[model samples]
Target chain A: MELNLKLNLDASTLKADFPLLGREVNGKPIVYLDSAATSQKPQSVLDAMDDYYRSINANVHRGAYYIADLATTAMEETRSKVQRFIGAASPREIILTKNATEAINLVAHSWGREYLSEGDVIVTTIMEHHANIVPWHILCADRGTRLRWLNLNVNGNLKLDDLDETLDGARLVVLSAMSNVLGAIPPIRQIADAAHEKGAVVVLDGAQFVPHLPTDVAELGADFLAFSGHKMCGPTGIGVLWGREDLLEAMPPFLGGGEMILDVTTEGFLPNDLPWKFEAGTPPIAEAIGLGAAVDYLADIGMPAIREHDRKLTAYALRTLPGRFGDKLNIHGPADTSERGGVLSFTFGDIHAHDISQVLDGEAVCVRAGHHCAKPLMDTLGVTATARASVYLYNDESDIDALADALERVGDFFG
Target chain B: MPALEDLYREIVLDHYRNPRNRGELPCPPAKRAKGFNPLCGDEVIVFVEVDEGGRISDVRIDGQGCSISQAAASMMSVSVKGKTLSEARELERAFKTMMVIEGGGSPSSPADLGDLAALQGVKKFPVRIKCATLCWNTLSEGLTTE
Candidate 1:
């Protein structure tokens, strides 16, 4: 809540930072709680992207021309920046892709699809979004590998004790650092250690993790990590998949195209190198430059400060909402916010989540409703869907207040 | 805040509180169809018991849904009960006309709808369109089997 004052810039100044946020929706400023879907971009990121195309837009690594050289250099520079951002030891570990979904599919298609074979097990959890679930299903069925899952507790935390029991003979562990619906933070460090003892490489779907908390790949002990750019105040169509250098080097190329090839022959085409081998065809150049700007923007604020700010928002909502709505409101996820992000998925009596979202929309408060791409988790929660108000760096106490006020509207709407 | 009466109009609340024909009919005698709204997991199983006249004699619907959906189903089953196939189809066509984008997509005026006009307030909330149309689709799907 302290950071509310820190971000207390004038209306025009805030609009200057985010031009899109200035646009009125339903005759009011958009509160934009759908950051969990994708974050709004800062003007700095848009300007950075514009600067790239206007000055140095060209095909990467294909020409001797200066424009191409400039483009290629800026493109590769983002790789190093992302590597440092996640605390990976080398730039070679970061592979650029369209989004976290693509980054995950790359690993499943290239590395997991091949290395895994009959009876080899890949461990996951019911809490994963379908992006994490279906890919492994395809990989396992094709490769004859077995896909396993860790269960959820009544409070929605990953049942790690059950996870330990499932680890026997497991070759890979795929999990989200945070539950997308419940806002439960699984013990990544502990899960990684358990998987390591079992000789399994751990892969984290950090799409929910990287945006909320400070992420250090080495500290978390993940062999492969994937996250999208748009969740972290960057452009869509850009993401980073950080793997151990050895794994990427050994994994076959996911997509074969001009940017990723060393040479072509009637016999076969050889790959260029580690990062490029994963990225194929015309890359999202503007998005990557925008990602670099986003990295700069986040780093300037410092991750710990952002983490603490959201912790306060989550904690405050936990303390406040139950009293106001009483039995009419049921908050999903845990009561504690120290172990979670500011994703509050809740329901007002028997009101459907879409109706709750619509009522909120009328108040200029934007929250996400429906399954949030985590249907299995929704099943576990015993609700078809929930209305979720998620927060990011730009959100503050007033935003949370707006959310609470909107819920009162929802309660009346269904009365 | 708006008055509670303005938000939930008495009829909407009445349908929610006491939904009609709310339980399922046995599948063997009743022709049933399953409808799922992928946007949300609002699933409905509509069962129509057809008599020798080849008309819907007893339309019993079963499902779990949000208020709009459950109410719509509650309203729909009663509206079409014992109607001729032509009448039932007319209601379905009229419901779909209000729910989905119109053919060549002209916006629907409330005057075009009658008793179903109670649902026009729901049109303002685009997100709830699927909820308002769940039973209509179930009716559409169930009619095919009958």
Candidate 2:
């Protein structure tokens, strides 16, 4: 008989493990609904980072001392954890960078400069965060490449009706797995298949997607997959870029410095092996270990349960916000909860998003208000800004209720 | 410090709902300059028509933004209309003084900030202070531009 011994986890049990969750804001307990921005770290992640500094504090892969060896082992161990976390083929495919922004820049500078040239086409979606869109824009502007945009449908999902034509003669297709604004998870496999059929490489921005969903890079058919650790209950300084072994081997070093080199002479230098070649300088050592602990924590809770929790919270918000405010509250994105993640971006009546956020702040309700680093999506949505509330595993129905009650105050305050 | 009622004083909300001098003024004497709060994406356009003696004969504030910003602009337009450019500049300085406070605490000023005094509550909300200042900055920019 097979043994199943995973702990049955939910918000109440897991909420106690995070230190910040216990704190109060304005006399009321803080209802943290901004996980999409950055997740709250568990005690395990914090302890792991502190332990690394206390016991195994040393530079990695350089010093031959005992602590150096232990530090090196710990750092490299995080790489393997990350590879397994996302179901990448091997640790060699994972390149640890400063953050997702640096990861995208790595691909843009290394692969883009080598393969792309003037007049080549790069197709991207309008729903992308500036991180995914801006790098390609710089590449296009510099190389004189032509960039095409994939528009969104009326429901805020990508309108790939023109994918076949748009992918024609395209060199690369860059897009997000899930929109940070709309919370819509685009059909990544379908998009990857289409891009592959048109002989274009696919770069998937998984910053928002990987946190709430189970990511299998090889199965997703992405040549490059990027995500940040901070968004997934890890520290802010580290992020991952997973690439096909062949593609990574073909690309040049993103930043040339100490760790990324095998041998450096007065005249020239040879790059280091697979992942290290991309990780040029002193890496985010403690942060990587913390991310490894976060990966372990998530694995313990199980991604499926987390997904279910997120879905519940999202559905609750979707159902509650509409029922409470009717047409007065305009929540953007897909109507079906299954089609989207937990992010809810919306406007309440004629009140500006900043004002709504201010009123919400009074009730200790945390929601993000701005263009969400998605100006193109803002233009498409016909609004300059929206107040966004996103949920994670630790968020429960009570948090959603708090949000609803606070929103009522926002409406009344404006009225 | 995080009180909503303090920030949303009735006078401020009144100005937001029914702003004074809120449309475009006829040109020839009107000078318009735009201001933008890139973080909130709040925008304001300040138009001022100066008299022969460098006094503002008419002023109009137009834009889309939060209550604090729109109301600040509305109240600002009301205060500066028919005032000399130098007097308007003084009001702008006093308003800036009122908005800047240390550690989200209130700022003390011996001189009255006039109608713009209603916006001193914004000092408690540091993030919204930029929204409060967008109009005054635009008015300053408009006066200096020709």
Candidate 3:
């Protein structure tokens, strides 16, 4: 027997904590199902930001004064926390970034684009977000290398057998651990092993995976991993790129500035060591503290429990939607929760995704629509765009009910 | 079978399935252009054969996308075939304006929209606007550069 998941948010807690969830869209309580886009911040993360600003607002890394020292300590604390959260080998392995886009870009521009020789093959999958795909394409374009892809299975899962075909000449394999649209969680550990066997390093796009699933950089066997804080219940404009210590030591710093250098002179340039080499100028001190607090908040509940909650929610959505709408609904990903994460991308009767999204908005049931930055996957799925309802821990079965009800209304409107 | 009105006007389904003038013409001494909506995986190749006095002798399109894109392309081919280049450009602009807004009704009069009017409901689909305008954007591009 399953306990009914309750969305009866404590009014005081909601008002005191989020303060934004109290917002009414179209005169209805907003039921956000677009966690894949980004997540809602908790009160702890917000308070951490406030605490940083109020108490220890100063530049980090090169500071000498008390406040600066505090900021530096907070910054390094976050590095350690992040390193532990992702199971990185060392705190110096985590490089602070602007976003996941920039994290992938650092690898492209710093490692592959600058380091790899011309004509080298870069292997990726059709399921990658444009963040992962475009950077590699740009790198390939600049370096005169070839960028190839492994196609997805009928259920939208990446076919790892294709890796043998793809990894022949590949110097690097970029894999998105979980797709934002299809919600298919690829066998990243297996793919990493294959890439490693082929002497190709694997980079995991953990933007979608890290927030929803339990991850270990070592256990997964990824050489590099990138994720954004906003998607993981933290502040915006902050991301982390964790690499193996040896890899970070070998790759050149992406950005050159005051902080990321050993010494500055008119004669020549000498780069700084490990993580600091890549960090560059003034880092986001307060945001990093907020992210650290967010990690603490998430860890308190444990990711395994959260993943379990989403698994049940996704299974509920898939099973109930077809029963209610029958032939009117078309789910785009795997039929079971075993292979997929928590996304329920679909079409309702004759209602287009855009039309359905708007009607769902009218009912305060929000979801993402369009290609979702995975155009190749969209083409493979034979849909130009789809309305995607992805569940996180905050989302419950009631959220599913709201979405199903609104989808029915959209069907009535367009069917 | 469901009624035509229940799904779409019978003409819409007809256009979507057996699209008219669906193949592209070579850049035959005339203007041609391409357009794509990377967000939706839509690509359009438009070729316009202009007769003397800026009149369109034929306008053909080639592309692959969802039903909205394909049907809109088919409708656009017929809409501009006999019209002047200026008329086609105006229809392109009008079609674009209609697709951006959700639930904005068609051009009020059937004669006002002509064949392109069938896509008026595309306005309700904001994400599908790219799909609806794939052909029109290519036509606009052709009108300007080619």
Candidate 4:
């Protein structure tokens, strides 16, 4: 796809919408580059959450009062918003959880527990976050199942040459849509198609993908999609698990409590319905409403525009970082901007990532420095940790320039 | 805001650039303990050979980490070598006290911390305190274990 200049993603104007962006750190303006970890919430999302707490503060589903109805409506409205945002078949298919990790865990506990057994095989990639990898590891350990890893090539692309062979006997395929560390966007649609042809269910970890790029569940060909609200300018406690309606109906309740059951006598209880059967306790009411506002904010700006902005910023970083530092910088992802997201994980000379991060903090340029919760991928990359600077819709060339400028300081300090 | 120089002192950087006693000892004679900071993937392996006279005969540290962690381990190795196990324990206590005290104050007693005193600046950077303490904790583990 070509970069469309018609998109209205002015980073300076959008930066004003997020209150946290206005703050200063260490006497300098905060240049946040850790959006892959969590995004700064916009004023609209904060207002939506504040409004819920201020006006419609009540327990959902149980209270019969006026505010209770408003609370329930506000929360459920988020489900519909997420459903529409991802183009899900229905809101019933969207199960709200604490975060993307819990969303993936729900699939492992509810669906994997029922379907998987001894001799079954699960296929996952080395590039997945621990959230996507560990749940399947638990299920495999529990059920005596085997896990097959799909390794990546030197350029960080998945080795899809033998994808059919890998998916031959796999019962389920779990992988990240975009690597949190490498920023490599795997060919999820092609992998999903291959998995389906082999009669395997595809579980997509969209935590990193959903926050940056335009996403459509059907287009991705995933049986289930999991993403977090916190990474997308929403509240921390809310996440989404979008599954096929029939698949969710067939799975058992993940957590059992008051709201998940219809009739709870002395005997075993019947699960409630599609989404509620999974959401056990009183959900994150204000957080869900905040996520709804976040969805509205992104929709208003348009995902395409946000994506184009990310592309431009990423392309600039890809060029500028290497152009300035030459062989001193080693960026660990696909070199092409088209094949990657805005995440820039790199090692500058022999300086350790933490030391680099410490120096960057002195310049008020915030970046993540660690294994990024993907230890297995870290092993594959042959590095203990990397300094990561990820761009978002509110980031522009100036942010990238600041990152490059700060990196020069790293060279001066460590050289 | 703590300056970067506060966290990465000249002595700390010196030790980082040229770490001392940075190799593993044979396990049959030396007790080895591993310390890892999972958040940053920093790993430190400490080998301590406690003599029958209760003195730390030799100490070696082998690992990879940021300057703070590596330098701390390097300083820790030099500080405890040839000292009695109890004296080493006292140094650990004094160093930890320095790390934990508010305003990065000196220890209550006049404990001879030597090069380890440079790590008191790490207290200013709260997030990096654990990095300075990782090797000491590992050495403690190594000395205590059979």
Best by TM-score: 4
Would you list the clashing residue pairs of candidate 1?
none
Q: Candidate 2 chain B — worst ten consecutive residues by lDDT sum?
A: B101-110
Better of 2 and 4 by lDDT: 4
Once superposed on the true structure, which residue ranges of model 2 sit more than 4 Å away at CA? A1-8, B26-28, B101-111
In candidate 2, what are the lDDT values of residues A1-415, reduced to their tens digit? 1122443447988899899999888888989999989999999999999999999999998999999999999999999988887888899999998788889999999999999999999999999999998898899888988889999888779998888998999999999999999999888899999999989999999999898887788779889999999999999999999999999998989898999999999999999999899987889899999999998888777777777778877988899879988999999999887789999999889889989888888888899998999999999899989999999988898999999999989867786
Each prediction's whole-model lDDT (CA): 0.81, 0.89, 0.80, 0.91
Output the worst ten-in-a-row residue range by lDDT, candidate 3 chain B.
Answer: B1-10
- Count residue pairs with overlapping backbones in model 4: 0
Candidate 4 residue-wise lDDT, B1-146, digit = tens: 88787787789999999999999999969999999987667899999998899899999999998888999999999999999988998888899889984335578774488888888889888888889989989999998888
Writing each residue's lDDT as its tens digit, candidate 1 over B1-146 gives: 33323335568767877988977788768889988887766778798887789678898878776677877888888888888888787777777666554444323564544556676566556666788788888887887773
Order the numbered candidates by lDDT, best leading.
4, 2, 1, 3
Candidate with more favorable, higher DockQ: 3 or 4: 4
What's model 1's lDDT at A202?
A: 88
Ranking by DockQ: 4, 2, 1, 3
Give the TM-score comparing model 1 with the true structure, all chains together.
Answer: 0.93
Model 3: how far is A307 from its true place, Å? 0.7
Tens digits of per-residue lDDT for model 3, B1-146: 12223224456656876888877676666688878776555567888888888899887778765566777888888888889877877776666656644335544345766767676665554556677777877787787883
Q: For every model shown, what is its TM-score relative to the native structure?
A: 0.93, 0.96, 0.83, 0.98
Worst 10 residues of 2 chain A by lDDT: A1-10
**Which stretches of model 4 miss by more than 4 angstroms?**
A1-6, B101-105, B109-111
Determine which window of 10 residues in candidate 3 chain A has minimal summed lDDT: A1-10
lDDT (tens digit, per residue) of candidate 1 on A241-355: 9999998999999988787889899999999887788888989988998999898777766677778877887897887888777888888876767778878888788888876
A292-313: candidate 3 lDDT, tens digit per residue:
9988877766777777778888
